[model samples]
Target chain A: MENFTFYNPTKIEFGTNKEQLIGQHLAQFGVKKVLLCYGSERIKQDGLFTTITSQLNEHGIEFIEFGGIVSNPVLSKVREAIKLIKATPVEAILSVGGGSVLDSAKAIAAGAKHEGDVWDLFIGKAQIKSALPIFAMMTLAATGSEMNTTAVVTNQETKEKLFIADESLFPKVSIVNPELMQSVPKDYLVYSAADIIAHSIEGYFTATDQPHLQSRIVEAIINTVIETTEVLLSDSTNYNARAEFAWASTLALNGLTTAGTAGFNFPNHMIEHSLSALFNVPHGAGLSIIIPAWMKWHHSHNTDQFKRFAKQVFAVKTAEEGIVALENWFNKIGTPTRLSQLNITQKDLPLITDNVLNNAKIFGIYHIYTKEVVNTILQDAL
Target chain B: MENFTFYNPTKIEFGTNKEQLIGQHLAQFGVKKVLLCYGSERIKQDGLFTTITSQLNEHGIEFIEFGGIVSNPVLSKVREAIKLIKATPVEAILSVGGGSVLDSAKAIAAGAKHEGDVWDLFIGKAQIKSALPIFAMMTLAATGSEMNTTAVVTNQETKEKLFIADESLFPKVSIVNPELMQSVPKDYLVYSAADIIAHSIEGYFTATDQPHLQSRIVEAIINTVIETTEVLLSDSTNYNARAEFAWASTLALNGLTTAGTAGFNFPNHMIEHSLSALFNVPHGAGLSIIIPAWMKWHHSHNTDQFKRFAKQVFAVKTAEEGIVALENWFNKIGTPTRLSQLNITQKDLPLITDNVLNNAKIFGIYHIYTKEVVNTILQDAL
Candidate 1:
């Protein structure tokens, strides 16, 4: 284990119907007004939007409505929300949808506090010194965004999916009502499982010094994601499975899994961002395509951890068997195992490699995933 | 899984040399003057006290010193500290020792803000609504009071050991430097191992609905504690093992393990408190003596979980074998396996049972560990 500092101040209100108390929580935190951010009309269709606004109204809280956030959330949406927040004075950002909404809300929160463009923070031109407090009522369980200090957003013009991580962006309070997630489409649920697993394993195999306890925590998250996803697929309304999956997803990347892990890298996410940016594929789908390929290419670097993953997660003896078992499980869960399944042709390899190299540079992982190395990984995916 | 709210707001500054920055952390939190609490002169002999006071002096922070907190800390010490704090205008209680010091500091912190007697809060006569902010630099890893909201204290006069758990008791910041724990005596280390294991497994067996993920986490903690304790016992200065053991101890009881387990119980701790209160035994030693015996008594109620614990933690097949294996491990690690090892004879059973019944009534666990049931468990310990 390596020297590290672990401090996550996000307060998660996880349970059934917990979303109904979001307004009360915000009020208790003295958030007088908030910019309510959401992705699609599904929350409205489910009457969740009405409940939230009514609760706020009953609490004597004021809010400005900002919707239309989309998956692979873009800088354009973040800019729009930032402009809205600038025009008005809101004390906080209340994200009422999924990861995309929370990501946009975080970007807007930081942008509203900074004098420069929000993209400046993502591109490392400026630092996020302070931001409006963020609160959330999550309707999805994929990104672990509710309790973390990072957000991913696509810069459409530049064709880049960039992220900003700063201590100031962590949500002050997040309400995770797994019951609200029962209506997630089967395909989305499958993709969410992949996303959670990706989070759990990314650091497990790459850290220079992985603590025994941290590895066990990562395995716990992986096991929970696999088990709960299977149950949720067979019966979507299984509340226990959904609750377990939801909490496990939050813990997967809330900084607990990688606390003492020095030299840990997120190369899979570094490569998959290119897939999402260039092809507009769902984040989890992009990961499913890249993970097994990356794992195979990188397994030799950390053979012992790979073997441990095999034994603990897949009950297999060899690293090769573990990678195959994971790939098979992804296929069983309806996630794409190959880039070709998403209809990308062999000719698209160079474009994907170029995008990934740019991300590698941004993430400071270019030393490991050089242009040629990324090309080989993409070829493996094909 | 059950509907639950998971929110732990304590900030942990974990890693090497973290203790050296305690003053800066307190300053950042706007603490001007603190009631510094600790145990015997070990910190003074080790120069840690001089280092802390110098850091505070450099930071221009003021403090009032309180020391001599012992293991299984008593209410009289807390009351003495509370009287000193009331006379002074300290902003927080800065604990500089292990769990005993932290527990005593927490009692003082809560009592300073309450108008009534502090024991009233522990006895269900009052609630803790506010407290002076608490901070800590932990020198020991057992009894995770650093990042939790609960503190146990024995009433020397009544011989009634009790605890008070409230959100206000959670420390504002806790610095855990495993190097500080490297000098722990081998016996104390073994007892600490038993304590960590007890915290991990208590909820695992008693949760009404054990989520697969939570169970895996419990097993992970148990595995890490067992592995790390063996290494530390041999080498004594192996930093990695010390760090892993320290961290696992914190996570074992920081509200994460029982997050979704609605009806989880802590019968082992409930029973062990009495042993400590009546016999003046070390907290972890009492736990080691009572754990296997309690498991044997309670295994029939949660047989599958016990079997799973056996298979995962010890690679055994049956619950009975698992219990025996754990008891053997305890004895191997130098913890007391039988009550008689502590010079406690069969004649002491009635006195111990009476003390445990008082604790059961206080903890509201009488439904599970009734007087007769606790008597049976204590008798089995003999």
Candidate 2:
């Protein structure tokens, strides 16, 4: 086991109607006003916006609406929200959608506090010393952004998808009402499943000193994600299934599964971020395409962990069978497993690789994930 | 899937030499002075005291010693510390030993702030609304006091080994350097193993609405505890085993395993606390004796979960076999699995039952854990 400081202070209110208490939670935190951030008008159509606004009014709190954040959230949208917040400052950021909105909220929170460009924080040119308190009413489960500090956002001009991590960026409270996620589109649901599995496996396979305890937790999260995903596919309204899937997604990247594991990096996420940045594919869709491809290429380097993952997660005999089982499961769940499925071909491999290389440099993994290595993995997807 | 607010805000610094940074951690919390709490003078003999004091001096933090806390920590010691703190107030309570010391520290932290008797907090006559900040450098793993809100302490006068749980009592920082635990006596190591497994199973079996995800996490913690305990028994100096065992112990009761599960109560701990309180048995020893007994008596109530536990943790076909396997493993690890092994006779059943009934009442499970039911479980232990 490696040395690690595990300190996620995000208070999660999980279950049905938890979003109704968002205003009370904010009030408890002493926030009189918040910048209500969301992805689309879907929350408004679903009555969630009214529900939250009514609660805020009940608590005598005020809010400013900031919508239009999209998946694979962009720096431009985050900057716009930051600008709005700067003009009419809110005490906190109330993220009312999925990971994208929450990630953008975190970015806006930091950017509103920072003097320089918000993109500077992502590129490591400026550190996030502090940010406005963040609270979330999650409408989706992927990205684990509700509980974690890191926020992944794409810089449109640079075409680079990067993340900024700081202890201060962790949300003060995150309301994860799985009921809110029942309305997620089928594609997005499976993509969330794939995304969660991606989060679990990255550190599991790559950690140099893979502690058995951490490995067991990763397997638990993956197994739960896989089972819950299958259950949700058949009956999206299954509250237990939805709850478990949402929780599994949150735990996947919430620092619990990766703690005490040494030298782990997000190679799959690194590559998928580039795909999402360049092709505008959904983040989880990009992950589903990249994971198997990367696994096929990288399995030899960590054969023991792959074999363990095979037995533990897939109940299969070998790493190769485990990879195949995962890809098959992804396909069964209606998530893309091939570049072709996303309408990308061998011709796109170079562009994807270059974009991935840029991410690799920013992630400080360029030494290992060079252009050649990335291209080979992308070709495997082809 | 339950409606629950999961909010553990304790920060854990886990790794080698983490305890050496205790002063810095205290200083980070703006604690200029602390009442350093510990058990025994062994830490002094081993130079841990010198190391801690030097760090305190270096950080310019004042400390007043309040040692002599013992295993199955008592309310008297906590009261003494509380009185000392009330007389000469400190910024925080710095616990420099294992769970007993930390549990005492939490009690002290609460007691110093409360106007009534400290035992009132335990018996639910009073609630802990606020507490002084707490810091801990744990030399032990069981009880998971390092990263949880609950603190278990025994009242010497009433012989009620009850716990007080409040979010306010959570330590500001906990330093878990597994290296510090290497010097633990062999008996204590096995006892810690039993305690961790006991923590995992209570919620796993007793929860009315057992979520598979939570069960998986509980199994993961149990599997890791079982595996690491065996490893540590053979090679106590093995850093990886110690680290995994320590981490597993922390995770067992840090609210992760029980989250999203419904209607779960700590019957094992409830009964074991009575045994420890009445007989002054070590917490884990009492647990080892009670767990199998409770399982035999209660398995029928949650047979499916028992079967799942059988297959998942013990790889057995029947809940009976799983119970037997766990008992045999407890015996194999040199922890007692029967009342006779603890030198308690069948005649003592009524006494233990009466004490347990007292706890059940306080725990609000008296309807289920009637005197007859408690006696039956105790009889099974005999």
Candidate 3:
């Protein structure tokens, strides 16, 4: 255990039909008018858009819309939204989709207040001193973006996927109605589970000192994700399973799991960002491929935690068994378990290595992840 | 699982040396002058008071001091502090001690703003819409008043030990330095452990619908409290044990363990409050005496969860074994597990029962706990 601070102030409104109250929640935050952000036409096709707009109107709140955000949300979309936000008189950002849309909204919220490019904040050239209040209605559970201060956005032109974390970026209010997630396709659901597991394990295996209590919490999230994911796959409309999985995913990355742990970095996320940035792979698909490979290479550094993870989470005896079981589970859930499975061959290794090295540099993990080390990890993935 | 909105906005600064930065934290919250509150002369004797006052002065903050709060804090102390705060120019209430001090600070923070008696809020005659921002530097790990929106105060006049929970009562910031708690006596430490466990199990057994993930979280808190309590009892100066215990105690009552659970009532706390208010027993001592007895009487209503507690926590085969194992553990940790151990006898049962029935009415659990029912549980404790 080490010195740490734990402070998350996001208010989560969860349960059936909670999303419809998003506008009223924002109104409570003094958000009279707002910039509404989302991805795709799915929400509109499903009538969620009308419900949200009617609620906002009922609350006497006005809004400007910025649609078409994409998975692995791009810098260009955030830039466009920032432009609209700056031109309009919106008081806050209301995100009405999954992680990508929420990430974009956070970026716009911060960038709208800054004078420079939003990418500057991502690349560390500038700091986020303040951000407009952010309100969210999450239709998906992965990434834990709704309740955290993390936002991952890709600069398409630069071919870089990076994240920014500032306490100011935490949503003022996040409405999580798992019923809105019932329409998600099967592949995304499995990928979301993988994403959640990835969140839990990154610090579990890498922390310099993992306390017994923190380990129990990480195991709790992992067990819930594993149990609920399987149940929801068999019956998509299992509302209780969806609710559990949704809440577990939020807790996985919401600053609670890593409290009092020391010297942990998201090495897996650092490498997978390149796979998403360069090949445009889905974030969780990239994670499923990278995690087992990273585990194979990094298990010796923290063998005891690895063995514990095996015994507690997988009921296995050794670290190797745990890695194999996790990889098998990913494959069983229809996610890509290898680079080749994602259609990336050995030929793409150098570019991915370079991209990962850049991320390692940005994240201050370059000492442990030199080009040779990254190459070897990618070779294991291949 | 049920429809729920979970929103806690307390900012916790946890770790070594966190208490020394309390003034700066309050300054960030725009507090210029604070009403510093604490219990006993222990903090002054231990030099913690000087450190806090120097830090506050360094931050150019002014403070007025109000000391001498006691365990199972009473309404008269709160009223005195509220009068001091109202007469002074304090911008916030800063508590520096254990749960009793923080609870008194919360009560004063609410009372300083209202014209009527603060007891009105506890009795539900008036609603708490706002309060002065509250801050804390905790020297103990029990009751979780540091990061929650609940304050339990004994109205000595009415002979009622009751609690008030409003979102506004949450401290704007709390500093938790486990090192500060190293001076706590062994009895208080064990009592704190019992308090933490009591908070975790209240919702675990009584919720109408308990989701699997919520169950896992409750178990995690219980396991952590149990594990750390044993270690700390033998080695009070162990920093890691103290840190884990402190963090786990905070999570136990800060709305994380009970999220998504429905129709739960704090029957154990309701009954224990009467024991404490009537006899002036320590809060956790009352809980330790009441819990096993309540379990013996109420196990049949939620038999599966009781069995789960046996298997998961005590590694036992039945609810009876579980209750005995817990009572044994409580005794091993040096807490009183029976009313006789605390020197209260059968002659005291009627008054305790009457006090508890009043609490049952206050907590809206009268249907579940009539005077006859309360008598039976107390008889079991004998």
- lDDT (10s digit) by residue, model 1, range B210-260: 888899999999999999999998899999999999999999999889888
Tens digits of per-residue lDDT for model 3, B1-382 = 6988888888888998888788789889887899999899888888999999999999999999899999999999998888777777688999999999999999999998888999999999998878999998999999999888999999998899989888888988889999999989998988888899899999999999999788888888888888988898889899999999999999999999889999999999999999889889998999999999999999999899999999888889898899899999998889999899889999999988988888999888999998888999999998
Displacement of the residue B271 alpha carbon in candidate 3, Å: 1.0
lDDT accuracy of residue A117 in candidate 1: 94
Q: Which stretches of candidate 1 lie over 4 Å from their true place?
A: none
User: Candidate 2 chain B: minimum summed lDDT over ten consecutive residues — where?
Assistant: B19-28
Q: What's the TM-score of candidate 2 when only chain A is evaluated?
A: 0.98
Q: In candidate 2, which residue ranges exceed 4 Å CA deviation?
A: none
DockQ of each: 0.80, 0.91, 0.83
Model 1, chain B only, scores a TM-score of: 0.99
lDDT of 1 by residue, A290-353 (tens): 9999999999988999999999899999999999999999999999989999998799998988
In model 3, what lDDT does residue B331 have? 88
Report the Cα lDDT for residue A120, model 2.
Answer: 87
TM-score against truth, every candidate: 0.99, 0.98, 0.98
Residue B248, candidate 1: C-alpha displacement in angstroms: 0.3
Angstrom error at residue A211, model 2 = 0.5
Q: What is the interface RMSD, in angstroms, for predicted model 2?
A: 0.6
